[model samples]
Target: MKSNVGSVDRIIRILVGVVLIALAVTNVIGWWGWLGLIPLITGLVGFCPLYPMLGLSTCPLKKRQ
Candidate 1:
């Protein structure tokens, strides 16, 4: 898939996902926190499936010659 997620977006997603997972592992949150895997995978992959459906993209546009 094309990388619709930019650097900053990816970083934020990774951080949020990590936090959620950490909380889950620490038993500070419910099992739902395991859902954090979603963002983590997407961020690592640099693509968001929802972004396509929503017609959104954080990637910088390529310059045309």
Candidate 2:
């Protein structure tokens, strides 16, 4: 799949994911925090499934001939 996540967005997602996971691991939040894996994986992969469905993309447009 194409990467729809731009650099800044990717960073934010990674941070948020790590924070949530950390919170969960430290028992600061509920097990639901484990769901952070979604954003973490998406961020690492640079692709968000919902982005395509929502018609949103932070990635720069590619040049066309």
Q: Which candidate achieves the best TM-score against the true structure?
A: 1
lDDT of 2 at 64: 100
| Candidate 1 local lDDT, 25-60, one digit each (tens) | 999998999999999999999999999999999999
RMSD of each: 0.5, 1.0
- Cα-based RMSD of candidate 2: 1.0
Candidate 1's TM-score: 0.96
Evaluate all candidate structures by whole-model CA lDDT and list the values in order: 0.96, 0.96
* Candidate 1 segments exceeding 4 Å error: none
Clashing pairs in 1: none
State the lDDT of candidate 2 residue by residue for 1-65, as single tens digits: 99999999999999999999999999999899999999999999999999999999999998999
Candidate 2 is scored at a TM of: 0.93
